[model samples]
Target: MSIKEQVRQLWKTCFDDDDAFIDLYFRLRYTDKINKVIEEDGKVISALQMIPYPMTFCGQTVATSYISGACTHPDYRARGAMRRLLQETHRAMFAEGVMFATLIPAEEWLKGYYARSGYATCFHYGLVKKVINSYEQPVDNSVSCLNMSKIDLLKTPQERIYPYFYEQMNRRPCCVQHTPDDFHVVLSDLALSKGDVWIVDKNGVMSGLVFCLMDGNTLSVKEILLSDEADFAEVLRQLAASYRAERLECIVPRADEMHELGMARLIDVASCLKVFSAVYRGEGLYIRVTGDEAIPQNNGYYTVLPGKVSRDMQEGQTYVTFTISELTAFILHDLHPYMSLMLN
Candidate 1:
């Protein structure tokens, strides 16, 4: 068997997934140059896949990587293989100038597992559950919800419009940005990540948009945009009815629930902060970051400036002290978790 096949077998054994699904994943979403593996006696037992993406933070696009499909075989579970892999990944990311690394743990409890590797909670993820109050029996008015062709979205816009469209998508505090090609690549990837982009056009103008996926009886809306409130309810009503959903769930930017849908960790603090246009209004504070006992390099005192990040500065009094997670929240301007990226 090929090494990747062996690794997939290990992944399948651990995650209870089948071969076809595994094949689709490898063929579709694999990133280049960052796949790491631990070999033991001619077999790959542990692996990590780092997929890099451009994330927008406070109106600026920055390089960030998504750490996903991370798994270690049961035989290698207690041998510190995964921890070493993560440490190596972080160092490589820093060297490559990638500012941040974000990931969605397969389960919520796994957040604590990655926290040991300097990953903190930075993503807010949850399903917004709203029962269909009214479903097409008597609609308020007709809202044209149509799926636009890829060609159409890429074309038909003004010369300066494409850049603006991509920019506005990332205007929120910290969002992952995707190009038109990225959208096509994500969707064409064997439809492994399945969803439809529906635009609500009214009177020859596009007013509302929804990107949703059907899960069993529920239609989970990953993104919904309607700048005008007047069209919001009616668009949602149309969406709920059109998708034939039993329950409509939305993942808001900031969640109020007890648990989180996803988590994030900083690969390099200085790199991440450097990408920010400006830090919060202050005379620059000294921060002493603690925790990450497993990784000693991350625990240190530092001085943060508007355009500078210095380490081990003795001149500042540790006015701000926080864990890596808290630092992530701070860098993200409250870390009100939204869809990091690739909702499809």
Candidate 2:
């Protein structure tokens, strides 16, 4: 059978859901690589897709591509369809001189699965916030929050906001590198499509910025960066007050390096790890992790190993051994709890 037929068969069987298929189809179509699928016998058993983005960071200049929507038919699963598709995609990306590939995994266990395939966990953060009712606006105190609605990206000074935003994000542990031009493009698109963006000014200079979106009753903060002198807490409070949102949410790095600038706090560590673990992958089998200190109920390290089993680390780094598939299953939440559910 031809590769195209294999991919069609695989998609039809694996993602039998019409809605999921439609979503997958649209995403694949948007990346402009759907036709790359190899077909055999009028069925698609395997397929791969790539999403391209122009990324700029300090010291390096290059356009990057991210791979997503990878799949193989259920019958072709153990036959190495995924491995071959990934291998081809990686080769193509390398030929294109792509910087790196990134994706949000569909399953947590897929992390270990991808790890064995050559992907690693780089950085992760969580979304958390308190829901406030009434609050005072920062503008009332003469604090300048630039209404992005009034500013034109084409007319604004790129030197003003681009450099500052890039520098601020670079301080975070897992932030992707972005160039001034790349930053401008991203911000310009968001500003045009989203609600008002608030910028905190110092002496007629842009110091901090925040982007907010309203979804039904909730106010979603897409990004928030502030200067050292700017009160991040006040900015958040003012934005929340203006929208009267019951809650505000934005992803923060796990290292909490930006907390001081934003006045943001970490509320749930385990949940954050669980969310992040969905993307990372590892090698080997039957892994174990042991430690010496008391593990916090909410925040604790874990060692992933073979057989979908994970040992919680208390003090020192405990040795762990496990199969790639097992670890993937565990992170994806596909594995059953070895311990009691109440404990988890």
Which candidate has the top score in lDDT?
Answer: 1
Clashing residue pairs found in predicted model 1: 124-337, 128-249, 128-250
Model 1 CA deviation exceeding 4 Å by range? 18-20, 136-168, 179-181, 188-195, 227-230, 255-259, 290-299, 312-316, 319-323, 333-335, 340-344
Q: Scored by CA lDDT, what does every candidate get?
A: 0.65, 0.49
Model 1, 1-344: lDDT tens digits are: 87767766777777755565666666766544668787888888888777777876755667887777788988779899898888778777777878778888887678789877767776655455678855655433433343222123333333333343464566666676666655554444324456665655555555555566788878777666554533555666666777667787776565454345556777666656555526545577687778755345667777767767678576536468878778876776464546534522
User: Per-residue lDDT tens digits of candidate 2, residues 103-131?
Assistant: 55556777667665555443234455767
Estimate candidate 2's alpha-carbon lDDT, on a 0 to 1 scale.
0.49
For every model in order, what is the number of clashing pairs?
3, 54
